[model samples]
Target: MVDSVKVAGIQMEPKILEKELNLERCLDFIQTAARQGAKLLVFPECALTGYCFSSLDEGLSVAEAIPGPSTEAIASVCRELEVYVVMGLLEKSGNKCYNALAFVGPEGLIGSYRKIHLPYLGIDRFATPGNRPFRVYDTPVGRVGLNICFDVRFPESSRVMALQGAEVIALPTNWPKGAESAPRFIVHTRAYENRVNYIAVDRVGVERGFRFIGQSKIVDYNGRTLAEADVSREEIIYADLDLKATREKRVVIIPGEFELPLFEGRRPEFYGLICERGESVEC
Candidate 1:
């Protein structure tokens, strides 16, 4: 894998139920980001199809199969530009529709991640919950993990990826208004705790009466913001990630007294309470 790579987060608004127009805009953004030297580019959740669907039928109407038209078109572009892309879209598999992210490279479709955690808001209320375990895929850039909007709220999602040797965690989110703490603080906390690069790409504009907050950003392994986009504008944020630094989880802050052994010090036996089934608590 390359030691350092330039990555980008495409933050744009998608027209509701306008698949053709959204695909066109997504292609344009991919081309633009490729021209700017971004090896890996990530788009927001439902970047091709807008969120906030009124019912399951509405979501099914726009959902497409994984190796279907959308991925084929994006794979062709990836082949031409020689860049890897991770984009979120509505995926239709058998009789179920899922909130999924597709990873495409210069060769073809690499892999995909179905959103495991489903929230009550937007299309997630109607989409089927993902059944697969959290996974980390090895890529030309580095080992990367995928997750969507509400999935970030659970620390185990990112921790599982980091445990599997993921150097970067890409979160394609649709963070609506009244949830500013996620991008402002949680994103950094996730990266710092895992010692891995984190990229949260969010869209802007109102959809189905609910407004989305767009503060797309990329944070390094040290939990420092490398780049961030405006809250209300369409923009692309880029950052150079160092693979070597991300792989080194241990941090020696004070030589001998305050060294942080991020991975080696894990006490997994006491964390079984997180897996025990119980009533959900509302914070």
Candidate 2:
């Protein structure tokens, strides 16, 4: 049987548009998590760029291709420290830009996921949507998935990952102050509905005139938050995800199927009734 995994969330501030500073900060955070005996570490969204970079040109300037500078830096720690790391980076893919996350492990770089849903605000101007819905990377610990800020809002996305045998859902986010509840609700609900672990790492402090509330947390499959950090403080949160207990409960409670209704399940006669009424499918 697989063993329980120790995970850490880096809830901290970042230097705006400076990849060097961000890389250094990540290295320190990785060391800190390793010292705490964490097997995996999750960092906040745009942890490298600190979100809200002033110009698209400037943001893209900082954006690096996956397997480029960012992953290589973390690759050293993964090899030396033997910890799995999920970190956010601005990705420049040809002419378009994506808010992306990279998964690094002791074996080297595992996989990268582009953020599917881009939140509105100034970010809408700089980021583009990813064509894919979910990305699950195979790690020594287990299969881990990535869900960016707005992607967690869509239940379809989370269910797809859970259906794919994801043992953990790692989220990277930047939310303005007073918007903390959304991340909390979304992450907790994902854990509960999917019967899998969920982690959310958020950025603290303001960047480029935007306020970010940090309340990073880790949730168990039963929707219990094992650990949560303060809103404003730059902190590192740690916890052990009891994979054994979660799988046992899955067999007992029999978690709902993580899938959507099919077209065959549709009531075409009723649908024709609604269309005949000159309206949409539902209220």
Top candidate on TM-score is 1
The worst-scoring run of ten residues by lDDT in candidate 1 lies at 274-283
Q: What C-alpha lDDT does candidate 1 achieve relative to the native structure? A: 0.93
- The pairs that clash in candidate 2 are none
After superposition on all CA atoms, how large is the RMSD of candidate 1? 1.8
Tens digit of lDDT per residue, candidate 1, span 230-249?
Answer: 99999999999987788888
> Which candidate gets the maximum lDDT versus the true structure?
1
Off by over 4 Å in 2: 248-283
lDDT of each: 0.93, 0.81
The count of residue-pair clashes in candidate 1 stands at 0
TM-score of 1: 0.97
Quote the lDDT for 36 in model 1: 98
